[model samples]
Target: MALKPHRSPRRVNLISPADRIRPDAASVLLKMVEEPPPDLSFIMIAEDLDAILPTLRSRCVLLHARKPDPEAAASWLEAKGLKDFDEQLAEAGGNPLAVIRGHKIVPDEARALFLGLLKTGKRLDITKVAPGVGTGWKLDACADFFSRWGTDLIRVKSGLQPSYFVGETPELQSIAPGADLQRLFHWLDETESLKRASSVPLNNKLALEKILESYRSVFRS
Candidate 1:
C-alpha cells in the first residue's frame, strides 16, 4: 500500500508500537523515516529495542521505557475509577497502559476451571476445558494463564515465590510434587508457541484441546 498522502503545510505524526510491525512493514517505514517529509514526524515504541530491526533502529532516536511500580500503577488505576486496581496492576505486570486500558484478560473463570483440572491430576478431562478455549484475545489469554500456571508449578517445586497465584500455594505444593519437570517445560514451550501464533486464523477449539491434553500429561501418577 502506498503511504497515505499527507497534505502539505500540515504537521503529521506517525506512531508505531513494537511487535506490531512485520519486517516488510518495517522496510517501508524505514524509507519514510529516512527521508521524512518536512511536515512529518515518526515515533516508534518498542518494549525491547534489540527486537527492533537494526535498519529501523538505526534510522531513529531510541528511548527506553520503564515499567511503573505496581503500587503506583494501582493508585493511578484507582484514581481513574477502576475497582480491583491492585489485582489489575499485578495482572498487567505493572504496565501502566495495560492497567489503564484493562487489556489483560480477566482470568477468574478460566483459573477456576484450570484449578479443577489440576486437582484431577492424571485423569483431567481435556474435553471439559476445551469448550472455553475461545479465539482472539481470549485464546491468547488462556495460553498465558497456562504459562503462568507452569511457572508457579516450577516455583513451588523449586521452593520459590509464586508470581501469578500467590494465594494458591497449598494447591501448587500438592501438584508440584508429582509434576514432571521435563513435561512441564515442554508444555510451557508449547503454550508460548501457541500464543505467538494466535494472530493467525486457527481452530481455537482444537488448539485448546491440544494444549489442555498436553497439560494433563505434565502430571505423573
Candidate 2:
C-alpha cells in the first residue's frame, strides 16, 4: 500500500525491513532513507531492533516506550469507585493492564469464589459451590494461592505455621487445623490438569462442574 500522505511538510514512509526486498529494491529503499525526497521523511516500524540491518539502525532514531505505574493504576481504580476494591486489584495479578480491565469481571464474585475455596479446605463441598466458582477466571490466584495453601496444609500437618493468604490470611489461619500436603499437591495437580482440559470440551460449564467435583474428591480423600 502507498504510504498515507501526512499533512506535515516532512513526509513519513512506514516500511518493514523484513519484506524480501530485491538487492536493487533494497538499494533504492536505502537511498530513500539516506536522502529522503523533498519535504519527505522515512519511518521504519520494526518488531525488534536486533533483526534490523546495522545500516538501517545507523540512520534511525530509537524511542523507548514506558509502562504505567501500578501504584498510580491502583489509585486510578480507586478513584473510579469500583466495589470490592481489594479483590479487583488482586485479580489483576500485579499487571496494570489487568487492573484497568478489572471492571469487566465481577470482582465480588471472583473474590467469593477464591475465598470459598480457601474456607472449605479439605472439607470443601463441590455440590454447594457458589456461582462463578468455576472457569479459569484467574490462573494466578488459583495456582499461587492454592499451591501455597497446600504447602501450608503440609506445614500444619508437620506442626508448623501455615502462613496466610493476602486477603484470606485470617480465614486460612483460622482453618489451619492439620493439613495433608501430599493430598493437597495431588488435588492441585488434578485441578490444574482439569482446568487446562476445560478448553478441549465445548460444554465448558459441565467441564468446570466436573473439575469442582474432582477437586472435592481430592479434598475428601
Candidate 3:
C-alpha cells in the first residue's frame, strides 16, 4: 500500500505514537521510508522522540512540538464538553489530544469507582462493579490508566518503585503480595491490547469487564 499511486491529491499516512510500531513492522517500512512514492507522505507522531528506531530517526527530519498550557487545554476540553478532565489532563501531561482521545466513555464518579476497585486487589468483586465502570466511557483513558496500574503492581511485586502510577505507592504495596508475577505480565499485555482496540469496542462494557477479569485473576494466582 505504501507504493500505491494517487491520481489527483496526495495520500497522507498518519501514524500516531509511531514509537510503538513493532520492530518487524518498522523494518518493513524502512525501505519505503528511504524511497517513498511521490504521491504519498507519511507523518509519524510520537510523544517521546528518542524511542523511535535509529534507522527511521536518521532518515526523517524531526520536529518538536511545544506542550500545551494545562489551563488552556483544560478550558478547551471543557468547552468541547469533556468535563471533569482535570485528572485525565494532569495524567496526560497537558496533551489535549490525549485527553480528548477517550471521547468521554464514562463520568468522573465511575472513574473513582474503577480506581477504588483496583485498590482492592484480590477483593475486587466484579459482581459489585458499578454500572458505569465501563459502558461507553473514556475508554482510551481508562485503558491507559488500567495498563499503568497493572504495570505499577508488577513493579511493586518486583521490589521496584512505581513508574507511571505515582502517589499509589501505598495501595500498590498493599496489592503487591497477592500479585502472581507471570500473571501480572499477561495481564499487562491484555491491558495494552485493550488500549489498542479501545477505539472500536464492539461491546464497550464487556471489553473493560473482560480485562478487569484478567486483572482480578492476577491477584488470585
In order, candidate lDDTs are 0.72, 0.54, 0.74
Clashing pairs in 1: none
Better of 1 and 3 by TM-score: 1
lDDT at residue 76 of model 3 (Cα atoms)? 87
Best first by lDDT, ranked: 3, 1, 2
What is candidate 3's CA lDDT for residue 220?
A: 63
Displacement of residue 60 (Cα, Å) in model 3 is: 6.2
lDDT digits (tens) for residues 93-182 of candidate 1: 567688676576545666677767866667889778767643343666677777887888898889887766666778888778888999
- Cα shift from native, residue 105, model 3 (Å): 11
Mind giving the per-residue lDDT tens digits that candidate 3 earns over 112-151? 7777889988788787664755444666667777877777
> lDDT (0-100) at residue 210 of candidate 3?
82
The residue-by-residue lDDT of candidate 2 on 48-123, one tens digit each, is 3654556766887887545446566677767777555554454444445555664433346655665676577667
Model 2 accuracy (lDDT, Cα): 0.54
What is the descending TM-score order? 1, 3, 2
RMSD of each: 4.0, 11.2, 6.7
TM-score of 3: 0.59
Worst 10 residues of 1 by lDDT: 132-141
